[model samples]
Target chain A: MVSMLALLITVPMLTAVIAAVCRGRFCRLLLLSGSILHLGLALYCFNTRIDGRWIGLTSYSEAILLVLTSGLYFAVCCYCCSWLKAEECSKKSLWILGICLPLFLATMTLVILSRNFGVMWVAIEATTLFSAPLILFHRSGRALEAMWKYLLICSVGIGLALLGTLFLAFAARMGGVELHDLRISEFLNIKESLNPGWFKVAFVLALAGYGTKMGLVPFHTWLPDAHSEAPGAVSALLSAGLLNCSFLGVIRFAALAPDKVGEFCTELLIILGVLSLATAAFFIIRQGDFKRMLAYSSIEHMGIASILFAVCGIEMTMIHLVAHSAIKMSLFLLAGNLLLACGTRQISRISGLFGVMPANAILFLAGVILICGVPPSPLFFTELVLLCQAPLWLALLMVLLLFMVFAGMMKNVLSMTMGKKCELEIHAAPAERLIWVPIAGLCAALAVGIVFGVNL
Target chain B: MNMAIDLVLTAFLGICLMLSASSRLVHCIRLVALQGILLGVLPLLMWNWSKACPGAEIWGAAFVNIMVKGVLLPILLIRAMRKAGVKRELEPLAGYSWSLLIVSVASALALWLSRSLTIPGVSVLAIPAAAVTVFTGLFIIVSRRKAITQSLGFLAFENGIALFGAAMHLEYGFFVELGILLDVLVLVFVMGIAVFQISREFEHIDADRLNLLTDTGEVK
Candidate 1:
């Protein structure tokens, strides 16, 4: 019980190490085994409860959702086995990823379990480091650029967070609680004792800093570039897993700030969220590159997730997070398959995916339905709940952005799926059918979520 | 009271500014070395002049600072400079004279700002030096074009942070300090890779050229 979260974090990390040492075909088998183990542990973690003096992990529902999300992860891992047949990427690169992937998972788990602000900051920074190699996995010109941008921007943003941490320390000292005796509970206990002025600054900095990682507008400049360039498996982990963990960091601070300050901050988040959606819609409509379009879509969903957290209740935010994960992962993996079959990432260059790879084509269409928040999809219900809870003005704006994004994504996905058959034929992987299983399962989960039917 | 040592230590602030403002690469490197040496001497002077208790840990910290900041880091930096073969800061975004003027103003502002803040139980004199060190580090990072200089700027930034930490009398315990040290080492190694990669790719290490990879979605 004491080590449940630790186990969840460590298992994948350890598996990554072993997988790295095992080369070629053995690596895929190792990854497959690791993913299954990870999924099971995530389920067990959800069922088990652990309490410590400063931390607790008794949220069974979140754990279950987290486990299901691991299904998408495992599926991507399977796809990666064949997708990354490039001989240039060495065994050492895989080793680094193997080590870093688990470390990344462990850090995310740490972020989830940590009730302390300082400890959580460290965990978040650790995530940044672990995810760096993952982003730079391909080591191409574009990948290098993306990794550099991710590092420099995140380091600068996280540096500001460090400044905020210092401010909190000062606030504690001001309240007659010296820095040495500081803890999360101390601040909560003496919430009134903290200098509200410094507290406000700290909260704002933390929000903007961590929100940068969450891919909110303005701080989201690196998102499309990073996501598009990274491998599909990495992209899925990023969109479905990492961003959720970052939001948790922001929510931690939002949970701390009192009334008007919290409201004001949440309002800022909502505006950024809306702007992110609007921005994604604008770009996705005209985006030539399919991967880039998917990248923008992820940003739009992140924005929606942020706004939902800001406006709606926790249940709405939590449900949306899970829905977004399933749909987004399926969407990205399907896109990866298309890229594999077409031999190009250009949207206009290739068409009639349905004829070439019918399974992926259908999966892509369903993913589009799910992402657009169409009925019977969880995102549709979550979007509805968010609109219901938000002010009418904000709701209208959100709905407009939602429609624009939906239209943009629909146009892209439809044209790519059902357009005229290519004059030239492209060979696709025989194993491509495996990608459908995860997509179908995710769609089923989405169906259940939309109905709010599951008692678990 | 070691007032002379205090004055010399504070003079390192001006030297850091001059380094940031300089167009000549070798000269900037020298200035950085000087600043590092000046920062290394700081703990000793503080120990000598401090009316309060000076423990063995403080002395140990001073020795480590001197060794790492004063002698070792600069030597590593010089080796990197020779390896990179970047002689002058070619195509600096901010001109040397303007950079110098801005650094002067920043130093003055930092002094004024530090004086304004009422940090209880701190020597008011120490705060200005710390603040200036911080701003100078910022100036170096912002003004310089070369990755190596920017790295030196980052080191100076840490110096400023260390100085501020000292002024605030905040103890981060040994583990946190060790973690910080490890992070800095990794930072240097990664930055070295960045420098080597930049040089290999473009045949020059100007950060302005590195801006070729911006998010404008334009042709390279």
Candidate 2:
């Protein structure tokens, strides 16, 4: 079991080194095989209970995150195989991608599996460094700007999180808890002894720090720019995989707070969640770019999941996370397809997608339906559970904000799909196999929704 | 020993204030390096190393912290600044005079806040210094126009956090400290590359000019 947990992190890191040194066709093959192996290991860990001394699945939340991360990586890797074929990037950039992508995955895996606050902080910070190049994959002026904002903002944010971790350590020391290391288990064992005042401060700072990475409101300034500017596969990972890893940091910190501080933490999460939703809704209504619109939707869904996390517990949040990742990954890949076909990201310029590229259009619309929580979608069930658990006023606001998001998304998606053909020639090849990636994602989302729905 | 720690922290706070008031990128980078050195020395002063020659773990952490934070990172920023061909921040969102005033006020507030929230097993002076440094770092990042300066601000912010960690006598594993140092080194390196690319493509690393990816309109 320990070896399995160790292999889960080492495989991608080892493959990243190999991919970085190797050149040409072998790089892509290495990435694909590494991702497949990662997926297999993730499945094995999921089926079996693997607990280790330093890192293991200590909670169901961690387990769910592991599975979601690996599943999305597999889907993105499969998509990248086809996407890389179409890419015209320089060999240097491809090499950077080959090296960074697996390293990015490795860091996230480490983040999920590690049981220590200090280790988790390092892994989360590493994610920022590894993924920065991926955002700059296009090497455009705009991409450069996005990468700058992402690196600076997230670094500062994560730096603050490090301070928060130190405060947690100090709080433990002040509480008379003898500890050898800053492990989560060590803190939890002596959680009652922790100074409540210091614990509150640590929790707030950690939330701000991880919340910035999670793309919650105010700290979410970096999200839209980085998401829109990055390549489609990278954006999918940012939304689907990276965001969840940061949220895991928040969850771990929240768990360590005392009862009173925990209430304060919940209130903070609720307020940030609502603010993020409202902010995303305002932007989604005015968003001109399709990819930027999806970015805002990510903020909205993360906001809703955060509210669920505070209100219901990890169970609902996990369900929302899995469902959102599946649907969002599919939507992002479909966006990539549209970009390839239309050659422009402007919603105003895109028209008659249904006629030009039927496969992407149908899948995109389906993704929208699922994301907006229309019916039978897992998000709908998750949101319903959220509404039931939330206070009346908060639930009303949530429903209202969700309605605005739904309407905004439908307006953009409908106009793009329903209008007369635009001027650009459709270059979308019949990548029927590529279309299956999102199909598989959608099916998985539906399966989780149905299974969870029945259990509920 | 207490007096020595106090002196180091006082100098750290002075540098934080200077950072906010300075407009030159080179000066800011140097100030950050100085702060990093002080932070590296802090653990040695705080811990009771006199009882025994400190283990390789403690000495190694101090060495890496000084090397990476003090020496390596600032050099990276200096090279980036040289390449970007910018020196002073011509225009800042918050003027240097006001930034100075803000930092002064923030330092006072930090001292007061630290006094109010006392945690056992933590250095009193270190807390206020850390708070002031953090505020100034954030102020620099927010007010500065040059991309390189912003990165420098982030470095200062990180240095402040490191000081706080050291002040608390929190004995993180050597590997964790080394991991943090490497992460910061990589962060600065990446930011340097980005600064160069931004200057090359847009002909300036002024963050104000990076208005291409706005929500107000479509690029196409």
Candidate 3:
């Protein structure tokens, strides 16, 4: 089991090195195989308990997240194979992608698997570094702009999170607890001894720091630009994989707060969640670019997940996270297909997508429906549970915000899909048949919505 | 020994003030390097005064911190500046006079904050130094126009945290400290590359000009 955990991280790092040095074709093969092995190892760890001295799976929730991250990574890896083949990328750019993508996966895996708060913080910061290049893969002026915003804003935010971690250590010391290392399990064991005042400060800072990474409101200014400018596969991973890892950072820190301070943390989450939802709704309603609209929707869903976690606990948050990952990944990937077909991300410029590319259009429509919490979608069940647990007014606000999002998304979908065909020629390569990838993703989301909806 | 630590801390605070009041990019980078050297020496000074022989791990962490923070990062930033052909910040968001005033206000607030937000078992000056450094770093990031200068602000912010860790006697193993150093190194390296790209594409690293992506307008 320990060996599996070690393999889970090292395989990607090794693959990344090889990809960086090797030619492009071999690099793609290496990435695909490494991701497949990672997914297999993640699945194997589900039933097996692996506890290392410093890094191990501490809870079922973490295990679930690890699996979710790996699953999304595997899917993205597969899609990248087709994406690379289709796009007329330079050899150097392809090599960079080959290197950075696996490195990004490795860092995220370390984030999920590490039990030490310090290690988790390092891994999260490393993810920022590794993923920045992916955002700049296109080398456009706009992509550079997006990459700069992502690197600087997320770095400053993560820097605050480092300060918060130190505060947590300081809080522990102030409470007369002697900790050998900054371990989450150790902190929780002595939670009663932690100074609540300092703990609250740490909580707020960590939330703001990691919350920025999670694309929560106030710090979410970087999200729309980065996601829209990045290639489709990268956007999918940022929304589906990276956000969850950062939220895990928040969850780990929030768990260390004392019961009284935990209430404060919950309130903070709810407030940020509502604000994020409203902010996303406002931008999403008037968003001109399809990819940027998806980015805002990511903020909205992350907000809902935070609110759900506060009200309904980890189980509901996990369910919503999984469902949202699948749905969002599919939407972004399909959006990628649309961009490929029409050579533009502008919603108004795109028309009669259904006639031009029926497979991508259907997938996009299904993703929209699932994302907005239509019946039988797992998000719908999560929303129902949230409404039941939350206060009346807050629940009503959530419903109204979600309705606004749904209407806005439907309007875009109808406009993009049902209008007369534009004169823009479809750049359909042999690799264009990979629309089935997102269709498979949609099926996976539907499966989770049904399976978890019933069991939970 | 206490007087020596106090002198170094005062010097650190003085550099923070200089950072805010200076507009020359080279001067700011040098100030950050000097600040990093002071941060590197802090733990050793504390260990010597307390007569506590920290294990090999502390020595290793101190060495890496000094090398990465004091020497390597500034070198990276300087090379990036040369490549981008940016010499100095022309129009800062806050003028030097305003920045100095804000820094003074921040220092006053930090002193008050240090008294109120006391943690047990840490040096009295730790919180104050951390607070002032953090505020100065944030101010630089917010006030500077050049992307390279903002990167320097991030380094200063990180250095402040390193000082806090030292002040609190928090020995977060050599591996974790090394990981932190490596993270900062990579972050600065990546930011340098990004700044290069921004300048190459736009012919300027002024962050204000990175306004192509907006909500209502059609994306270019």
Candidate 4:
């Protein structure tokens, strides 16, 4: 029997090729079936043990990333079905997403399964390549520009990651470790022998490189544009799947840091996280494009997650990712619904979403409440812990930033969802019933958040 | 052996400096290709080759390096350039003289930086040369106008990393090298398509000017 891990990686890639060849209906079928099957694989692999070299290990982070990726992908695929059904996408775009979506899934799964640093870097790079096309789904010049920035910036970032991995390997090699055994698991055991200077350099490069992918402050210029330009489902996948995958790389490298280097790494992440939050706070306020607003919020949430990972520990960080992924996916999908209903994505242009689409408006409102780290949401506790971890001044500052993000989001969400009835023409198909996928997602997020708060 | 390796690396550094100053996209593409071929051959000279068996991994990596970086990538970039009708790089953010001076400064800095952190086996100059190439490659990407040139810049970027990786003689380097080469191949291929679309849509591939999407959404 083939390794379930091998199947996990290859299955979506196979579907991608098939979907590209098949016509319209068949393509959608392939997407739906492929994702459903992939989701099953994710569930099946969740607890099952596997053994081998290089790709054998399944750490807590990898497992969570895999499940989140597969689950979010399945949700996005469900949304894509309804989304495509309602609005007639260009054949070119449908084909592009059809091929890229599965390829994206495959590469993401590959990234999760690889225990080797080199394999993970390659998989991450491949993910960037596959997902870049999805950003061009609309064929708009703006989308083109976004895709170009994404491709170029991410390529540079991944190249840096490669260099980091090489440096890490060099550090290990200096300890008389063989090059072929440059698995991260090996590095952990022999870290004492690794040169502190080179190890620090490796960690720094890995942070910056993977941090770029995760949309950290300095390297986050590509995130908002890529997120907004891509169709809603792609945005959700990028936010939920891609970012977490990059965080996995960071988490692994941070794991490799010894005592002194570890402090430097943590401090680095903490400072970057605060800067990212500041960036998000600055941009999220009154941002006109709803999609772009959501994109900025992603940066904000990632900032929170980064700080959590740096201070609170990996378990908390993982929970934050799950909660954020569930809530953010719901929000972006809802935003997609809004985009379909009101021809424009501009917040100012959209009014009385409550009157226009009642179901989505409520879900959108609920999503906003959830995302803003409302009292009951796990994020509230997460934020509280982050505050506790930071110095008094920085904590207060983070609180202010979080408040700004919440205020800005609420201002936009309220006006859009609860304002006086301003009738806007519904341009796309009525897929109001399709809200079930995100609804389930949000409810699950709520349950998890409640559970997380108790567990904490 | 050290002198020969340093000579190749110095040549690599020289090409990187020239690349920073070059304005013509075709010229840049060819310079990158030459750098690629040098990258392909450097591994051959540096790695120990026994008469009994020269090792397939070495030859395969070298062959893939030359073919992809030297031949495949340049052809893809050039064809994209011609198709996009992007000729000489026009009005770079930095002027030619300034770009040259900055690359030189970057080389000096890299030379200084690598001196403190030396790997015992690798050539001393190899690390600095790789650093200069990476710096110069990034410089071209940011400072240049055309998307094609940016793609060429990206290729050069990969070449620099490859130069360093090859010089290190990393164990399992062969597989990693092949994987990276394949990635660069697809990256350029996709870039060609993007450049074509941008040119067709806007009739120009000026990367900086391609920025229509902004956060302060002017209700378009």
C-alpha TM-score for every candidate: 0.86, 0.97, 0.98, 0.96
Task: Please give the CA lDDT of all the candidate structures.
Answer: 0.69, 0.87, 0.88, 0.85
Q: Write the per-residue lDDT of candidate 3 for residues A27-73, one digit (tens) a residue.
A: 67887899999999899888766667568886898899999999999
Question: What ranking of all candidate models by TM-score puts the best one first?
Answer: 3, 2, 4, 1
Residue B65, candidate 3: how far off, in angstroms?
0.8
How many times do residue backbones clash in model 3?
0
- Distance from true location, Cα of A63 in model 2, Å: 1.7
lDDT preference between candidates 1 and 2, better one: 2
Query: Can you give the lDDT of residue A129 in candidate 1?
Result: 72
User: Candidate 4 clashing pairs?
Assistant: none
Shift of residue A95 alpha carbon in model 3, Å: 0.6
Q: Can you give the lDDT of residue A228 in candidate 4?
A: 91
What is the docking quality class of candidate 2?
Answer: medium
Model 2 chain A: weakest 10-residue lDDT segment is A425-434
- What is the lDDT for A90 in model 4? 80
In candidate 2, list every pair of residues with a backbone clash.
none
lDDT string for model 2 (B105-194, tens) is 988888887787666655677789988888888888888888888888888888888887788777678878888888888888988899
TM-score of chain B of 3: 0.94
lDDT of 2 by residue, A1-456 (tens): 878988999999999989867854477788899999999998888855655556877777788789889989988998998888886788888889899999999999999999778888999999999999999998998898899889988998988899889889877877878687887877877888888888988988899999999999989999999998888889999999999999999998988887667889899999999999999999999989999999999999889988999999998899899899999999988887787667788998888888877888888998998899976888999899899989999999999999999999999999999889888777867433468899999988888888887888
- A1-456, model 1: which lDDT tens digit per residue? 756666766777777667656643366666777777877777666766665543456465446445655666676666666665622467766766666666677677666766566666666777777787787776666666676667656655665565566666666667666656334555567666666677787777787778788787888877877787776677877877888878887776666665546777787788888888888889888877777888888889888888888888567788778778777777776666666566567777767888877877777788787778887787888788788888999988888888988888888777887878886566655426547545665666577674673432
Docking outcome class, model 4: medium
The two-chain DockQ for each candidate, comma-separated, is: 0.27, 0.79, 0.79, 0.69
**Which tens-of-lDDT digit does each residue in A1-456 have in candidate 4?**
128878888899999889778744477789999999999988888875553565754575667778888999998888887778787688877888889899999988888887778878888899999999999987888889999999999999888988888889877777676656567677778877777788888888898899999999999999999999888888989998889889888988998887767788889999999999999998889598889988999999889899899888998898888889999999998888888778788887777777767899899999989998996877787888888987888889998999999999999988888777665677434747669888988998989878878877
Task: Please tell me which model should have the higher DockQ, number 1 or number 3.
Answer: 3
Please tell me which model should have the higher DockQ, number 1 or number 4.
4
